[model samples]
Target: MLKYMLMIVFSTFLLCGCSYSEEKISTFEGQIDYVSGKQIKVDCSNTVAANSEESGDQVGVGYICFAAINGQTKLEDNNGNSLSINDFTIEDKIKIFLESPKNIGKSLESRKFTASKVILIKASPAPK
Candidate 1:
């Protein structure tokens, strides 16, 4: 009986520890240095938002709505971190490391990427 009780206690501790670590996943920050048909590049800051967008046509689990500048396109989150690969907006605020985009052909409205993280940086308003 004592052995079984000890096993249960250890298992519980392990499960709890795993959850705590998952919540502490590392986050990066950077400016949107570059963007192209296939990938994008963000300069790094510190804090970042994972999921935030204006709602899209095809919505589902792990799918966050985002609006690309031109072509009025939406992005799907097949990648690990949906927040990491959000659409880029010219006036968007972001903080992330440099990386390439996975899928290509995504429209960039006026050639500007959608904002990745809402928390990373505060996008300035467009000129009047």
Candidate 2:
């Protein structure tokens, strides 16, 4: 009986420990730093839609992370058009989303997980 209780307690703790960051995850904006095969490294920066009425906003995030694209990953443009991983280019601005993204230890740490969706917001050239 004691063993069962301990197991239940441990399981609860593990489940509760995994939480998404509303601020960071909701506004997961970054630039493509590197890409290799199915994964892309993003340099996290800035807050987006902080005061909007959008839903599904999670909290906390990292400064850098790796998001992988697979069969289930959704790639799209701002117009809601479909896209493929090949369409992505380095230095492109993007906002990534994860169904259940995991973080490294604590807030603003780092991430290395698969992406659920990726939205492209094409990069523009610098002003002359």
TM-score (all chains, Cα) for each model: 0.31, 0.57
Which model scores highest in TM-score?
A: 2
Stretch of 10 with least lDDT, candidate 1 = 45-54
Question: Positional deviation of 33 in candidate 1, in angstroms?
Answer: 1.7
Query: Candidate 1 regions off by >4 Å?
Result: 19-29, 35-40, 44-70, 73-128
Q: 49-115 in candidate 2: lDDT tens per residue?
A: 3322233434223345678788898889989899887777788899888757444323334466678
Task: Give the Å error, residue 110, model 2.
Answer: 4.6
lDDT of 1 by residue, 10-90 (tens): 999999866521122223444455445545454321211222122344322222122232232223222323333345545
How high is the lDDT of residue 22 in model 1? Answer: 13
Highest lDDT, which number? 2
| True-structure RMSD, every candidate | 14.6, 9.4
What TM-score number comes out for model 2? 0.57
Q: What is the C-alpha local distance difference test score of candidate 2?
A: 0.67
